[model samples]
Target chain A: MVEIIVCFKHVVDESELKVDRANNKINFEGAKTKISDDDKNAIEEAVRLKEKNGGTVIGLCLGKADARKSVKEALAMGCDKARLLSDPAFQDGDAIRTAYVLSQAIKRIGKYDIIITATGTTDVYSGIVGPALAEFLEIPQATFVSKVALAGDKVTLDRLMEEGVETVECDLPLLIAVAREINQPRFPTLIQIMSAGKKEVVEWKASDLGIEASTVGKNGSLVQVTSTQVPKSARKKILFEGSASESSERLADALLKEGVVN
Target chain B: MRFLVYSEDIDVELELVSAALKSQGSQVSIALVGDEDPKENSKTLSVAGVSSIFQIQDPALKDFLAEPVTSALEQISLEAKPDFVLIGATKRGKEVAPKLAVRLKLGCITDAQNLRFEDGHATADRVVWGGNATSTVSSKSGAVITIAPKANERAAGSSQPDVRVLNFETKTRSSKVVGKKAKDSAEVDIKNAQAVVSAGRGFKKKEDLILLNDLAGILHAAIGASRPLTSDLGWMPESRQVGLSGSTVKPKLYVAVGISGQIQHLTGMRDSKLIVAINNDKNAPIFQECDYGVVGDLYQVVPALTKALRAKTGR
Candidate 1:
């Protein structure tokens, strides 16, 4: 039986993300937590792949336990099993450490045919973890996947490219990181929600995974962020008080005055 | 203390990162991750005075996919153990750097405009919220820093990748590299271009961009615009927009036309070598910041400037 492990992160809401102008730190104060949009798409993709091809879907949630709920969301989405990896040490971790913990979890979960993930989290908008995990797992990966199908042991898929889309065939047990063009995300059903609620959330810590602290979290990190504050935004609201045509003309006039239209 | 400026085997990126780090007095090293032969990548990194270049080449790395690329870094970091690792804030770097940092258990500053090390620690200038604010952030612990794409303005100079080969057994999974797709930029590309001609909302419509493009073609410059040009109006893609929400650009000559120089937009193009502004409003922020200012209507003035430049440069 083919087993697939999906890595996902719960990030701050992108629509509500705020920056404190006093300092350049992103404001999570007004922001609520959300599954990284890409990860969410990945979760949906994994579920669809499993439902169609018949495989076990394992959800790997590696972040603060607060993100444990995120795994429940995954279980609701169709994951057979979910693991929540959280420790105080893992808080505010950079992407590398997060991937490390996830890798350890994957290692522990052993014997997987595929690992599926989303391209990136919307907040930081960093799309690094997918390929990083593929390398860590020693597997080949395709990014920006659109259409995917499995025949026998090989899978055929399409990638959206600059010039033209290309089709490639790869053996199974590969990694896939989805870009924005994948299928629209699926909404959970009543049955899925109920199942997810009952689904197990396996918890693991750094010690549980036998990952050395010196190489696994902030202590092992090489770069240090000395400060995080929001940037100061220009608060001026230039309202052209006039009709659309008037507004357009006035705006044009303003642009000329500013030397922007000249 | 040294800085490892990581890049995908791109020529322009190699030069920009090395130049920026070297100017900052950090012994810069490069880890060019790709399927290409390591020798060439190493040569590209070395010309900029990079002490050494590390390349992890496997058939798995060709597409610049995030997973394998990031894992390679884990091995590189453990071995090189540089004080700080920098990645360009491009699409690939955006995906890979954070994951690489997570796996390596390192701190990272993404889209940072500036970097400074004191007492062997990294201080970074990270602009967030469309450059509405500037946050001077330093990781209390180790970090994996990502320089915002096109945000660095340093000129590319003599550099070669001082090559080293680190064969890492990448642990990859289900993901596969189907193919790569590049986005078309409506404005001029400033990623590594020598000169740029950019406009803000003041241009009003896509119809006004012809003169901008014409001038750019004559000047051998790339065209760019404020975020609204691409992000909201859909005239251009986000990849070409210059602002906090869009791509950041650094060029030798940045011509701001009909641009009011909002902070968010300016943050992306503020690092240009020479800035010239042509706007009707003398009070626009761009006027104060630009090296030269011309007050006029772009519709008429741009064509005139284009002709004048054509004659001056004999293009």
Candidate 2:
């Protein structure tokens, strides 16, 4: 049986977020959070592989204390067991620190054939965590994977690149960062959602993982946020309000005047 | 002060970093990593403010597997100990930068559009929340940063620089590339197109893309799409998708049809010189960001716009 660990993050839904123009900060008050969008696909892929190959699917998440809900959500989606690493010290941890903490938790879990993660998070979207985590685990990583096939002890993946697709082959004990195009995630049924409460969720503090407090959170972060501001629009927003034909004529005229077209 | 810039090829990003370093009175050296010979590229790089070049070659590097590349760069950084390490924020760079940062135990900044030195640290500004916000960040010490493509103008210099070949041994890794295939639609280079005609979920069917194709033909533009049209419906090739996971384009003119302007899609095209959106939904988010917006069905609006453009240009 194959044992796989999938990692996800709980992120504030950006569509519901409001920016404070005067202070240049994001207003997350009263905002609803969800499992980061792409992580759903990661969890779904893990569950599907378990169904086919008959293995255990472990859900792992590292975030603030509020992220326990994300572990429940993952359980409802078919994760056999879930683990959460929550601490106040992790509040300001950046990608590098988060990857280190997650790698430590994976190590504590003991046995796993593969680690799956989303390509990037929804809010920050830096797309660096999985690769960095692979480094910490001393495992080979295949990122932006669009397709996956299991063959005995090796896994083959079709990786999406900027130019085209490349087929890559790697052995077990590998990490894969899957793109959103890889699979359609499943929605939990009402029964599954209810039963998710019965499943056990193990919560561990940063210290419980044997990581020193100074090396697992903001204190270990290398980068610092200096300031944040709304980007200014550089173009004049001109709307051509009318019938399709009328608007099309006006748009063409504007483009002509600007010499964007002949 | 000294700065190190590395890329698979000698591109505009190297010149941009070189110029920034030169303006700061810092020495700049470049490391070009790939299978290609550096003799010809050295000529152009030398004139772009590079004082020396290190050509690191290995057959395994041709595919840019993260393990070997990161190992090679780690070895190079150990010796150079540059004040900063800059890499182009391409697909490969995004994967390599973080691993290298972990190996070197340095702070890493990805997708940096602007960089500055302040208070004994390297500060970088990058877009967040798609393109809605920009965050400026700084590291406590020397950092690994990936420069956003086309973030600055290419620099020019007069002197020819010396080139050195570095023979670093690459460690063996488990992953290997078995095959490679060019996308069928690889010829449509949306990244460099002057004008782009893009479609969205408002496209009712795959065949409906013909209307967008016709409009692109009239405008001499490339055809692009929102994620669904490519990833979900396969109406267009993956190469034509424009979003956070797809290609980021900065064309001179971008005409969006039926795109509701999700933050992900906006990040890919919001930097265009001019934006025109045509959608039936008046409340679509695209209306707010576009220079010109028409609240009408793309089925009707796109053909009318195409005809209008043809008549105006007598094409």
Candidate 3:
């Protein structure tokens, strides 16, 4: 049996973010939050592995209390149980601090054969936490994994890279960061959704894990975000609505005139 | 300031070298990690501005796995004590930066677009919020940062730099490379294509993609897919997928067919020189990001556009 752990995040949907060009601000107020798109693949892969190898899939997340709603969906999608870290001390953490907190939480979980994470998150998209956590745990990691096949205590993975794919083999007690190409995340059926409430959801505060407050959150972070701005789009945004043939002809003519086509 | 840089790719290293040079009076050292002789790579990488090149070689570092690479970089970092550890933001760099930072008990900033030094601190601007916003991040202490791909011009230097070879005791490698497959040359490569015809969920069926292929063939464009067409429907291979998780392309001309222009998709191709979108909904967000937009069904617009291009070229 492979004891699989999948790490995920609750992030505000970036697509819903409204950019304020005049003020150079992003209005994230009331933006909808969900289990980040990439993390869903991690969760799904965990469930699939558990189904094949016969073990438990545990979803681990660190976020604000509001993230619990998203964590429940992880359970619905086949996490046998979940661990939520919603301590105030864990808020506003950089990747290093975030990984520290996650590593500590994973320590509390104790036993796990495999740890899974997405290539990156939707909001921060730093692509850091998984490898950092693996470092903290002193484990090997295969990032950008497209395929995984477990045999006994060894797992073979197809690691996607810019130039090509490399087949990798790692022993048990390894971390794998999956890409979107790895698997199609399943949408939970209504029955699963209804029953998820009955499943175990254990929330942990920073104190619960015996982590120092000074080493966890904003105060503990070495990097500080100074400012953010949305770049103004330079596109001309020319639009043509007409009969299909006419619109097509106009677009083709424009392409030629623009000198993008020979 | 002293800066240390390493990358799996030499081109990205040049970009890091350029970024490091931006800090006035900055001394940049490059770390070459491989089992092969570093003399050739060191010479190729020794731009005039670089102060030194460290050739780090060990049997355990034979492969590009994160564990050994992080361990090797960690050892080099502690010994060199650079003010900034700049890694090229390739797929491997993303994994290694954080691991190295945690090992050094430092913060890590990933995919930094620009790096500047002032008032005894380093600040980096990065695209965050899924490329919807850019955030300027800084560190109170020295940090590890991965430079975004192509973020700076390749460094051009004309000085001979000293090269130092360092060998570490072979550490136990946890992962092994069993096989490798280079991207099939016959596979359609949209990353380097001048033009791309991208499909989206609006594509009704797998066979309907023929319309895009026809259009792409006429325009000498490669085929790309929105996340749905590739991830959900599996209509196309993952390589052809273009989005946050897929290839980030800056083609000269990008024609998005039926893609709704989600922020994730836009981030991948918004930098294209020219963008065209076709969709039935006028209010589709893709319209805002496109240089030219047609508010009509892709089923109709794609075939008609193919016909129009075919007629114009008379091929």
Candidate 4:
């Protein structure tokens, strides 16, 4: 049976959070967290692959202790088993360090045919963790995958690019970063949610993975957030009030006068 | 001081890096990786601010695979030890930067805008929570950074610089490109166009895009759409979708019709010079971000705008 692992992130739901303009900080206090929008598609794709090809789907998550909640959610979404890597040492870990921890967990989890990750996380959206993880695992990887097909031990991917689509082929044990366009993620039903509580969730701390604390978290992060601020727009924001045609005429006149249009 | 700018193609992002490096009084060297001839490629790429060009050619580097490109760049960096490296934040660049950072044991930042050198460290801003907020980050010395496309002004053309061909072999064994296909040409080039007319979910039917297309025609603007219009409804090609998952466009004018201004969509086009939003919902989030907003039915407002533009331009 094909063994597929889907790596996902539990992120602060940005819609529910409020930014404190005074300090330029996002207020996550009392904010709800959920699986990142793109990770949902990753989990759904893994589940679909398992259903079609007769495989076991395992969900992997790396975050704080709160990430245990994600393991249950992934189980509800049809993941057979889930693994969580939680430690205070993982807080604010950059992409490179995060990939290191994930690759280690994957190694501990044993053999796997394929690993899937979202193109990016909703909170950070750097889109670098998957590729970095692939590097750590020393495995082949395809990013921005919009379509996937598996046959035997070969995987075919249609990678999305700026100008065109490139179809790539790689052997099994491949990692793919799926874009949101791949598939519509399914929400779990009440029965699935209730049964998810019974599934196995293996938890691992930094020491359990044999990773040194100095190399796993903020101390290891190379990039530093010196400061943050709301982007100030310099637009004039001139409002034109009139009928549809009249407003259109006025807007056209303003644009022409500004030399934006001839 | 030395700076290295690497881009597979000679594009605005490369030019912007050249300009940025030049302004900082840093000697700039560009690295071009592909099958293109060094002498010929330098002719078009050795614009105003570049002092030298390093052309890296290998059959293995032909595809957009990140591993090979990262390996090649790593080899170059090991020898040159450039103080800074700037990569354009394309799909391939984002995949390669972190891996390169991990390999080189250097800091890396992605999607940096308004980058400047401060106290020997590279500082820049990036949007978070889609586009609702921005964060300013500074990287340690010897950091690899990916500059967002259209983030800076393009450098003016100047005399060609000297070209130096580099001997490097790509050692990528895992991934292989099977085939490649170009998107349809009828799709608008939002990246390069000066103006764009974008559609959103407010577009009830595929045929309604005609109104947007007509407006685009009058303004000679490219037609772009929000994600739902392209990915969900299939009303338009994916190439023209504007969002975090789609094309990031920075046109002189961006006219959004029926788009509710989701953060994902805003991140792609928020940098536009002038934004005009026409939506029936007065309380739509787009109104908060747009420079000019018209709260009315797109069916009526778009046609009127098209007519007004035609009357003024005599097109």
Candidate 5:
């Protein structure tokens, strides 16, 4: 049977992300942590595919030890096994280092056919991990995948490409990053929750993983934090507070002046 | 000097980026993350003067899904350190970049069209409110910065660097991906095309597209549309849209049939080799920027244009 691993993260909730000017650090106090919305989709996709293919679904989470609470949710979601690599040292981990740590664990786990992930995370929504991880694994990758089904030796997928849907066929042991459109994420049933409670969650650390500090967290990261702000979009709404005919006429005129409606 | 770097990596695309720290006299190492084949893509990037290729190749790295991608990117950033990171200013990139910045204690510059290195740090130039005001922002935090990826040409030549593998561990949380469906479209991709014919909300109805297709067929160009033309009336998928919240196009020849070139929309196709605007209004914003403008009703002008093209090419 194939082994499929889904990497998940517990980050500061979006509504609570704030910048502390005094220290230039993110205030994590009282900040509720939850699995990233995009990561949830990744976990769910892995669970669904595992169920269909009869493969093992393993969940890997990185962050503080407190993140285990979030890891439990992955177990409840249908992951057969869950592993948490939480350490005080890995708390402020960056992407490149995170990839290295996770890749080593996957190699230790051994024997996998397919891996899936969500399009992006609510925090650090760089949307680069899917391709980066695929490159790390040295496998052919397909991004923006919305639909997937196992067809004999290859996985048939519908890629949410630019204009039209791409019906792609790739061999197994491949990487596919899923968009929100790819699957309707499923909630773990109560029975699954009870079973998950009994399931084991393995733990690892920076030293336990045999990683160097220069390549793990802050020092290992290639990019740094610049600034954060709400997307300030100024909408000069030409509110046509008139009848539809008047609005349509004004819109048409706007189009004509803008050269749209000729 | 300040360098506006573009990296699709999740973790490191922040505001307080300091690439100059590594190389005393070079631009910040930021550019689009292309294919992950190190020997092929990395060699190409090396020739372009990029210091490193922050590659994330987890087994799950295929699609550009937002959430998990954000999570994994956090992993990559923790590994390969760069000055500033930029993502494509598409829908997913816009949503993901700002959110990702927050996780890594970073900031973001939205919808940046161009990037340059300045002073002793990197400052990004982005339009504040759409196209109303252009602002140049500098970050003392030296945090990883995220900007909309520009149509940056790939640096010619190549260098092969060590391909570092990153594997991050995480908990499996419950979220369901139960169904999958694709937004259907019948048009060609505006980015990869050589020439394009686009429409805007001015077309009025679906039936008006016949004239557009005829003209496009004669010109040997594919069809595209502004955001409203496809989103409001559902004439096409969001992917075919050319404007803010859509794909950026730098085609050779772009024909605007019924489009009133709003700045948000114009930014997507502004780099076209030649722009032809067809609008009844001679003073339309599109006319100002277009290489050629025809002031006439599309009902008559379209057929005439098609006939002229057909006669000239004898197709």
Candidate 6:
């Protein structure tokens, strides 16, 4: 039987984020949180793999304690067990520190066949954690994976790249960072949501995972965010209100005058 | 400052070289991995700002697999000890940088832009929250960062860099490429296109995209689409998708037809020099972000615009 670990992120709902253009800052207060879109795809893929093969799917998350609510959602969708790596020391970790923490937790678990992750989180979109985790754990990784076919311990993956797709093969004990096109995430039934609370959920801290304080959190971050600002551009906001043909002619003339048209 | 730059594509490598050169008194080195002739590759890479070229000639690296490339680069970094490792942020580069960073225990940044050196530290800006805001980050210790493709100017100078070949072990490779399927050649390269006409869900049907095609054909522009047309409706290939998840375009002129202008879509094309939107709803968010907006049906506006442009330009 295969043992799968699906890693997901709890991030600010960027769609609902409010940018104060006047101040050139983002207002994060009162913002909501959810499982990132592509991470949900990772969770769905893990659940599907478990259903296909005789195996168990364990949900893993690294977030604040508030993330437990979202972690329950993973259980509702189908993780047999879950682990939440939440500690005050883990705050403000960059991709490197985050990957290190996850790798340590995986080592503590001591048994896993495949680790699934999103190509990148919707919030940061850095796309570093998966490959970094693979390095920290010393496993092979296939990123941007759109398809997966598992047979015994061998896994075939179709990786989507800018030019095309590459079909690859690797053994288990691998890391696969899935793309959005992999599969559609399913909604949990009401019963499933209710019963999800009964599943095993463990909250582990840095001390529990044997992670030294110097190796995580803002203190250990290699890259520091020195500043942040909203990218501002003043659009002309000119409106051409008329019949389609009239507006079309006017737009063509205006574009030609602007010299943007060749 | 010392910088190590590597990319699978020669052109992007040159751009990274140029970016590194932007910092005065900087020494740039490139690690080239492949079975190809290092002398031939170094001829193109040895620019004015570059100090040396490190070549790891191996057959296993010919296919652009991350495992082997990372291993080779790791080998070079151990010897070079450069303060900054700049990798081309292609699909392969993204995979390679993180693993390399973990191997070296260095911090890593992705999609780094506006790189500058300060007090022996490398600092750069990157887009976050899907282009809503920019974050300026810095790393005092050595770091691995992926440079977005075409993010910087190409390096130009008469100086030549010394080339050193090293033998690297590829025993770490755990996956193998069995086959590859190239995408259709018909798909336009929107990233390189000077003008683009993007479609959105406002189209009634798939065949109706002909209107957008006609407009783009006359303008000599590429065809781009919002995520729905490519990912959900299957009207176009994913390459034609212009959004946070798809290709980002900064063409001189961008025409959005029936697009509602979600932030995800806006993040990709907001950098275009001039933007125009045609939608039936005046309140569509696309109008807020466009330089010029027309409140009318795209079916009528698109064809009429095409006809007007065809007549005006005499194309």
Q: Could you say which candidate leads in DockQ?
A: 2
lDDT of 1 by residue, B5-110 (tens): 7766365466446434644566766777777777654554555456767778888777665666777887777777776777776555666766666566556667
Tens digit per residue, CA lDDT, model 5, B1-315: 333344444222332133233335654443323224434443444543445555545434344444455666666566655345555554446445544565565544454434455443445555432232344555433444444433443344344434454553432221223234454443345566777889887687887887788877755677888877765577766667786435677776788877877665776887776677777665556765676556666666667666555554467
Across B1-315, the per-residue lDDT of candidate 6 in tens digits comes to 889999999999999998888888888999988878777778888788788899998888878888899889989998788888999988889899988888887778888887777787778888888667789888857888899876888887757678888987757847999999986654447888989999999999998988777788888899999988999889998888897768778999999999988767987898789999999999787887889999999888988999999899998
* Residue-level lDDT tens digits of model 4 in B1-315: 567787665675465556456546787777778755556666777677787777788877877578888888887776667777888887888888888888888788888877888667888788877566788877767678888766666665765676767777757667788898987664447878999989999888998788777888878899899999989889888888998888888889999999998888998888898999988888676887888888888888888988988888999
**lDDT of candidate 4 at residue A247, scale 0 to 100:** 82
CAPRI band of model 2?
medium
lDDT of each: 0.67, 0.84, 0.86, 0.83, 0.59, 0.88
Please list the residue runs of candidate 3 whose C-alpha ends up more than 4 Å from where it truly belongs after superposition.
Answer: A19-23, B170-172, B186-188, B303-315
lDDT of 2 at B66: 88
Taking the true A–B contacts (Cα pairs closer than 8 Å), what share appears in each candidate?
Answer: 0.31, 0.81, 0.92, 0.72, 0.02, 0.89
TM-score of chain A of 4: 0.94
| lDDT digits (tens) for residues A86-199 of candidate 1 | 877776555556666787889998888778887666555445567667656766677666677888788887764433355666887788777545666788898888878787
The regions of model 2 sitting more than 4 angstroms off are A20-25, B19-23
Give the TM-score of each candidate. 0.67, 0.95, 0.93, 0.93, 0.52, 0.95
Task: Score candidate 5 by lDDT.
Answer: 0.59
The digit string of per-residue lDDT tens for model 5 on A1-262 reads 5578888878777545443535534455797778886688788888888777787988888778788888898999988888888766664455545666776666666777777766666555445555445545655556677678886667777765544466666777777777665555677788987788888899987677777766666665544344433332232223332333333344334433544223
Which prediction has the highest TM-score against the true structure?
6
Clashing pairs in 3: B48-B157, B48-B159
Error of 6 at A132 (Å): 0.5
Of the candidates numbered 1 and 6, which has the greater lDDT value?
A: 6
Note the residue pairs that clash in candidate 6.
none
Stretches of model 6 off by over 4 angstroms after superposition:
A234-239, B188-192, B281-289
DockQ of 5: 0.03
- DockQ of the candidate models in sequence: 0.18, 0.74, 0.71, 0.67, 0.03, 0.72
